[model samples]
Target: MTEDLTFNSKMAAVYEKNTRISIPTYNSLFAMIQSYYRVQLGEKAASLLLIGAGGGNELSAWGPSNPGWTFTGVDPSEEMLKIAKHKVVELGLESRVSLIQGTTDDLPKTHLKFDAASCILVLHFIDDVQEKLKLLGSIKDKLKSGAPFILVSAYGNHDESELQARLNVWKSFWIDAGRESSEVDEMVRSAITRLSLLPEKQIEELLAESGFMKITRFYSTGLFAGWICHTE
Candidate 1:
């Protein structure tokens, strides 16, 4: 699992390029998140905490638009943090954004609480489902009552047989780009796999058990995108 973290750090470096190929889907999902935040938090100044904040892309997109907001991005990878720090500087958002290097299991509890938090494409990497729920529970504790926690994860609604077929297509695409078989295997394994997909019901139940109220699924796309939000 530690090696998985290293692989994820490498993956983050290539994320921008990968997302470009899937721009429409990514845009729609981000739009949903933004709209949800605006409606839930209203027009007031707010603070946001981003868990697994690889590359700091989300903050870059959302921060300037909401000038009064402050963002704290936390991730476990030093490589990813380096990229995020550089991005913050490049965007001239140093005053609005802060980067912290740590995992959910080791987050600093002393930091000021946030108005909202997001965990995008992060929970699946945690091998234990219970631990993942516990992480969400901890994040909820770091928020004031009525604060929102938005999450996105792989959905389990896709046909497993078909997804495997499409993954074979992706595998071929990687091979055509000159990656070796072992390299492709490692990448595919570390990327979201079928096994990582969780059902929508399970997600809502976990969030509820973690003390989140008013949990709702907002957007989903063939097991690729699943967005949910709840309040503390």
Candidate 2:
């Protein structure tokens, strides 16, 4: 197996391209996330904490239109962070974006709380449920009361036939996008091996346990799901 999930330099170089290929509605997902924030926060100056900011997609998509928004992004992958930094520079958002090369735990102890946060295309990478809770708890701890938060993740029980059927459709999406069948097969295998897919109900449980409320499933495509909620 190639272990393509690892965000090394090689993978980082092609991350955005591959991601778009894998998720047909990739761009729209970010747009929806921003839309949720816009509806909640309005045109006021607000700070955002982006978990898994290595891809820079959130920074690039949300920065220009919301000039009043400032972002602090944290990711554990150095190579991926390099790509995100380049994107921030390219977008000329140096003043509004801060990229940190570490996890939320590495963030300095501070009393500052953000107005919003996003965890897009993340979470599934952790196979452990406890770790997932920890990440969600950390994000909750960083937000002000009733702050909006968005989470997009791969979900569904891998052992079930319904999810397998969805996986088949997901594979065809890649193949239709021009990826070689064998390559797509391996990618799917890698995903099944590495991703920690849970049933939708379990994901909601995690959100509620982490002090989030009004959890609503706002988006779904193939194996991926998105939810919007507010910190409690």
Number of the top-ranking candidate, with lDDT as the measure: 2
Reference-based TM-score of each model? 0.78, 0.93
- Report the backbone clash tally of model 1: 0
- The residue pairs in collision within model 1 are none
Over the stretch 117-188, how does candidate 1's per-residue lDDT look in tens digits? 998877777767888888888888878778878887765534557666655655665566677878878876
Show pairs that collide, candidate 2: none
lDDT of 2: 0.88
- Shift of residue 96 alpha carbon in model 2, Å: 0.7
Q: What would the per-residue lDDT of candidate 2 be over residues 107-183, giving only the tens digit for each residue?
A: 77873999999998789988799999999999999999999999999999978998989888888888998889999
The whole-model lDDT of each prediction reads 0.73, 0.88
What TM-score does candidate 1 get on C-alpha atoms? 0.78
Model 1 has an lDDT value of: 0.73
